[model samples]
Target: DLDEVINGALSVLALEARAKGLELRSEIDPKVCTGLCGDPGRLRQVLTNLLNNAVKFTEQGEVVLRILPQEETSSAVSLIDGISGSQAALRFEVKDTGIGLSEDARGRIFEAFNQADQSTTRRYGGTGLGLTISLQLVKMMHGKIGVESEPGKGSLFWFTARFEKHAAGKAALAKQKPLPLGRVLLADGNATDREILRAELTALGMRCTSAASGEEALQFLCGAIADEDPYALAMIDMQMPGMNGVELARTIKNDHLTKGTRV
Candidate 1:
């Protein structure tokens, strides 16, 4: 169930990125598996916020989605790193090449409403509830969240959660229906989310792209149609710095550039 939920969260992010025309990549080790004694919906929500934040901030470059077997460490450090181990410890990481936070900001980044700076909040336009909510959920699920960033470079947000491998018979029997690869757009201020999403889309056999904001996503859509290759559908995030999802979708569906394109 947790794996399914994790796949769903990854799918959501991937679909969003494709809709925006951003490149996404993922490296989920097939050997790394886990089981969770947690609420799937809440877990998915927390994962969604972190992934969304990564995609929202990235203007260009790649985002990475990685799953490692490791335990949560501490908050005193600037970055979190770990090596492979015998006992299983599932870690979910979203790394992006976007506007990074200063050391001062990274300290309180997980706190509610606390971003890199006031200007970051204003320019990026997030409720700041994402990481806060994510932290709470991680703790509730017996996990930890950490952030590593360098100004003008990028950020890596990671969390560790417990998981156990599924048995072969049951694991083989359990399956999820394949998700269709439609035209999707992910609008965010982060690049990590975009890249991770892009990777997931490709894994699902869908074409994907990345955009930093709704404006960029619109521009991409317009350009796609201008190039005579439009999307079939779109999966957009409601929050963005410039134009919101509704406006962007309208611009694509109601305007000449993407009027023939699907939402």
Candidate 2:
């Protein structure tokens, strides 16, 4: 499944990201086809390579993976060779908040055995073959790959690939239940994780509000109760700065007005 492919890629580099105190998140467009006919192994490899590089270069902040369906048109279809009737074009992006690349560095980024500069090689050791291999794999899958970056502003690496939809999976997805509407409060110190969860919850037809700390969450909770629109659920991260998840849960439980809200 396409989900497996994306998750697998992330799993391989999860530890590395956590080691650097970085948040790893994904924002997959709901419209993108989930079950696709393609080489999952190669797809995972390409994704993992990009993510691994992103995590390695980023010391703090977050790394994000975004997937979206590309517009299908006559010209687009013609560009991707071997795209059959069942195939669809999709775009994958790996964005990072790390040391960005210069104009010269971006030009030869995908070249084998090369990096931004000699100092970069000394600072972060690598053969610089990852992007080169990713380029080859993307081409094999009838896709195009490129990068965009500005010095000190991080980078966004993207690629487009074509995959044929799985007939059975599409039918199963069509029969899934409709999403329920509800209000949700997300409390997390990590900006990236909060944003990711908010996007996902919003996509599921829930109204979401985010707070950076337990105190902030409590304020929102009480305000929501006063508005007569209390949140149906509060998703809290276990490890937070000011107050942890357990503390917040207890606070919510003790307050009679907010007690009714689920934690």
Which candidate comes out best when scored by lDDT? 2
Tens digit of per-residue lDDT, candidate 1, span 117-216: 7787788775478888888888875577888899989899888765334465235434533368666666666665666576667656677777888888
Best by TM-score: 2
lDDT of each: 0.70, 0.86
Q: Give the per-residue lDDT digits (tens) of candidate 2, residues 61-175.
A: 8899998876743334455566665777888999999888889989999989676778887898653789999999999988888889998898999988888889976776676
Clashing pairs in 2: none
Candidate 1's TM-score: 0.55
